[model samples]
Target: MSSITSFNDSLMSHQNFVLIGIPGMQEKNSWVAFPLFVLYALTLLGNITILYAIKIDPSLHEPMYFFLCMLACSDLGLCISTMPTMLGVYWFDSGEIPFNACISQMFFIHILQAIESGILVAMAFDRFIAIRGPLRYRSLLSNSVIAKIGIAILSRGLCVCFPFPFLIKRLPFCRSNVLSHSYCLHQDAMKLACADTRVNVLYGLIAVMCTVLLDALVILVSYILILKTVLSIASRKECLKALNTCVAHISAILIFYVPMIGITVVHRYGKHLPPIVHMLMANIFVTVPPLLNPIVYSVKTQQIRQRICSILHLKRTRG
Candidate 1:
């Protein structure tokens, strides 16, 4: 027990970590920085524009737009979580992160990712309610009710991710402190611990089972039911129109979950895969969704698309 206490004490005494910044790719961060910077810029501009459009246009005052706004906020949070540190590593090779800051990043990243999943589920639920229970949709998911659902979504993510950083804290990281990704992630940090990590592994697995995995399964089931409801429509045109309405949400879900699944797969069974592959996959998991989410909605969502076009046209007229 004394040895265990000393090990825990020693781990707590350490307060620094090094982000290895993508093994063989760190040498080319300058070249990498340009694309990353551009993606970060697009992520910021795109999501912010969505929020701004939703804010200014009263036509977008529906439940769908409201959820899209929430989604935009989550995407923005995700971008802010890792952009600076990622740029620092790419532009200046500044990969040293304080232990606490790393933990903070890990916490927010997981929380935001979880929140994003929850939002997608809510969006799916909205579509479900709209299609399956169109007559009662408003009464079932009114403004006040939507607010409560939002709170529950955020609360669930907080409850699930709250223990992630603390779980890592209990482990003694006597192994190398170099992280392979541009950002701090739970798996990245846990992998560096030399001690027995079975408990951490179990907790992490349970968290995933309850959160992302469960969310994905719920999303899948929602879509299946959505498809069934759409199929019941008498007119084929109506069915097409209904499915078309879901294209943006489906895209958002795919962009968010597919890369995440890839990251998990790479971590679990890609031992023989190149280190660069894992790093690139992790970076994509962070960057792609934020970059693509707003674009998908802007292009696919009619009200937001029209508002954006009007804004651009007005800008052109002024210019």
Candidate 2:
């Protein structure tokens, strides 16, 4: 307790921090750069391709496609947010970040993450309306309505993440400011601060519950309802068609959440495991979603597939 108070008292002098990038790699840390750079590049290309397909295809201007565009945009934001610092650490061994920059990075990364979670919920809602209320879905999710939802999504993320940096800023990082990873995570940064971080931890927990977990629950319930609705339909072909449409989205959601949850569990409870397990989980949690999201959407979504193929000058043959 005294140590906490002493650390809080010394909050004003912190100027920068060191991030321990891929500490488990040690000698192999340099090799990790190759994969990181490849993921960064592939993610950029995939998301850019998705955005371009949406932009050029007027058929994709509807709410579903628009939400996809938003998802791609958010993925791009997530990628760009950490790319520089991550690369610096892996490639150049430059792990030091100024205090303000670290704060900025954390704010953007978390906000983008929050935005992605909200977008997934919104997308699930879209699928729900499409499957359960096909006749009304169009009218229910008009252009104005979709636009409002997008705005609300952005606002929710911004409001949720706004206080995190400020909360961390108040607590002086008196202990070594060296973070466990190449990224700036709220909990990671908080632990570096020697203050009584009970407030930060509680708020962080509340934030996760309100955002990611809530979104996941809603999605699960939505799918259950959708399945029930589809099963009740008499036409087998129609049921299959509806499920097919959902497959791509389900894959994308799983890709994002599985590793994210793994990392979260590892971060909180897997302290007993090797450090490399945590690092690898952390690496894939962020990288895999962006890397696979566009690819899944492009391959599994017929419209997107056709558009992408056309962009590559591939000719489609009529069967």
Candidate 3:
């Protein structure tokens, strides 16, 4: 269409597009692009392998592995949804995203983010039942129960994240189109809107509070109960074993949530920090979690480790 052509023309006119206007940060050269491209490839391959390993291994057909599979799937979705566009912007210096494409990316990014939060909460609840009421965990967390919860998590994520992009669509973008962050994050993207974005901002805050903050609170509560139950077991060996199993999950949760909270806080209060600092924090928030999730879960879960070994052998045999 004419509009598309015009947009493309505008993008083509600029040979050097700078996101932050820093002296050296103008347009992503191959140096930055190559490293991120490699990281993205590894993240995709690692998470997808974990997903398939969970699916094919009979020994991992339990609730924990089921949730782990779901987590891996969400991580894949997260990486694919954000990384390509980010890398494109960095690599080609093509910061000119079509309006529709930007909106679409925003939708998927928010949805996947919400799903990750919900899945983490579900995983925490699974741990709570496993530690607090092992006898009932099987009955309470059956395949049917987990299936229903997964459906609900996906549905709720889509429902909550839908309004965010829709709200963004309503706002007219007359100001600069360049985004502060690598990808089109909702809040950062909204900053470029020439029209009033009070409603979008308010709605986004509500969604984050309900989906991210509320889920985090529930995860914390589940862990608190799990810790209490573990302590009451009285056997030092048993306690250590239980803690060891959970240590990886706890560490992953901390790594994922801490930086997220850091970004939120810095965006709100630490405006004095340099743009590069903000950019670095945002990159960390996206990259660190996915890369670490498979490492932690696979390293901690015995069944997954064995399954991975089996798969690697099967691949070798086939080759």
Best by lDDT: 1
Clashes of each: 0, 0, 0
Kindly list the per-residue Cα lDDT of model 3 for residues 1-319, writing each as its tens digit.
9998886665553322224322256643555778888889888888988988888877778888888888888888889887887687678775566666777877988888889899889989888888877889889999999999999999999889988778877776655566777776788878876678889878888999989989989988888888888999889999988877777678767867888898888788878887877877887778878888998877887878888988899899999
RMSD of 1: 3.1
- lDDT value, candidate 2, whole model: 0.88
Q: Which numbered prediction scores highest in TM-score against the true structure?
A: 1
Candidates' C-alpha lDDT? 0.90, 0.88, 0.80
Sort by lDDT, top down from the best: 1, 2, 3
Angstrom error at residue 199, model 1: 1.3
Worst 10-residue stretch by lDDT in candidate 1? 7-16
Q: What digit string (tens of lDDT, one per residue) describes model 2 on residues 208-264? A: 998998999999999999899999989999999998888988998998889888889
Q: Candidate 1, after superposition: displacement of residue 319 in Å?
A: 3.4
- Indicate the worst ten consecutive residues by lDDT in candidate 3: 14-23
Off by over 4 Å in 1: 1-14
Off by over 4 Å in 2: 1-13, 314-319
